[model samples]
Target: MKKLAAGNWKMNGLAAHLSEAEALAGAHAQPGCEVLICPPATLIARMAQTLGDAPIALGGQDCHSADSGAHTGDVSAVMLKDAGASYVILGHSERRTDHKETDAAVRVKTEAAWRSNLTAIVCIGETLAEREDGKTLDVVGTQMKGALPDGCTAENVVVAYEPVWAIGTGKVPTMEQIAEVHDFMRTELTARFGDAAAGIRLLYGGSVKPDNADEIFAVSNVDGALVGGASLKADDFGGIIGALERA
Candidate 1:
């Protein structure tokens, strides 16, 4: 399976920000891995056009459950697809906390992503308190079981593990710690879904940056990353991609 290096520009970007996508397009992406940028909804179509044939896929930050509805402030998966997004992020910790989104809600959104033929990057994570209490696995397991939609294949779903405490906090788990969690996740996935799990991609998030990208990518079952702050700058994001290439 190819590694995925996705950038989530969460709640940021404007019309003029399309230049960032252009900058990313001009940069050399790591060979053997896929690069995707999930810009705010407004720039998806323009970014897709800017990155045409550049090996960089365009995506959406989030999507609504219903395809088309009276949901005044929501953007549906169908609309994202129509705007040229090939992927949609779901169940991000920020969204879950800020919007009080439940696992069932995430499942609905995941199904909506598939309905529009978009790959869903489903996020599962543990809060600081849960981790401190050694309930990380339990929390993650529950999220996965509840958020994942039925009939999702490895091709259509990518799992991202982002410890809530670490996101944008300049903190990261040790290599051993990350390996333990990822290995456990892989085992759980295999047990639940059988051989199909082997091909599924598992990505780590939360403070992943160019400096630590190589070591993190070297960890077992860590196929790639969902980068946050580091992804804002073309050079920093490109450096992480370079690390993945070397790894």
Candidate 2:
């Protein structure tokens, strides 16, 4: 499977931010690994246009399970695809906490994304307290099993493990800890998905920065990163991308 360097901008970025997106695309027109940026829904179309022929890809932060409905504030997978996004993120920790999203909801949304031909990047992880309680693997295992849909393939699904506490807290797991969780996720996927699991990309997302990116990518089964704050700027994200290329 191709390594992936994905950025989840979350609720940040405005029209002014498209310049940074443009610079990132222009600077690395030929990145070694697959490059993706999930900007705010407002910027998807413009960023897609700005990215033009660059190797970089565009994605959405979230989508509703319904194809089209009167959900008011919700955006559907069909809408995201029409806005030029080839991918959509689901079950992110923030969405899980802030909006009270459940694993079942994520699974439904993931299936919705696939229905629109959009790859689903489903996130799974444990809370700080859960980690402290020594339930990291248990929490993640349950989330992964519940959030992922049936008939998933590497081509349409990617799993991201983002420890909730580490997301923007600037605290990262030790290298060995990261390796343990990733290896466990790989094992679980292999057990459930069979050989197809080998082709699925697994990403680590937290306080992933340029300085830590290379070492993280070097960890066993750490295919790449789902960067947060650092991904907002071209220079910072480009540095991480450079490290992934080197890794």
User: Tens digit of lDDT per residue, candidate 2, span 1-247?
Assistant: 7799999998899999999998998899889999999999999999988888889889999999999978999899999999999999999999999999999999999999999999999999999899999999999999999999987889999999999999899999999999999999999999999988998999999999999998999999999889989999999999999999999
Candidate 2: clashing residue pairs, number: 0
List TM-scores for all candidates, in order: 0.97, 0.99
Model 1, range 104-185, lDDT digits (tens) per residue? 9999999999999999999999999999999999998899999987776688999999999999999999999889889988
Residue 149 Cα positional deviation in candidate 1, in Å, after optimal superposition: 1.7
Tell me the TM-score of model 1.
0.97
Off by over 4 Å in 2: none
Model 1 residue pairs with clashes: none
- Model 2 steric clash pairs: none
Q: All predictions: root-mean-square deviation over Cα?
A: 1.2, 0.7
Error of 1 at 72 (Å): 0.4
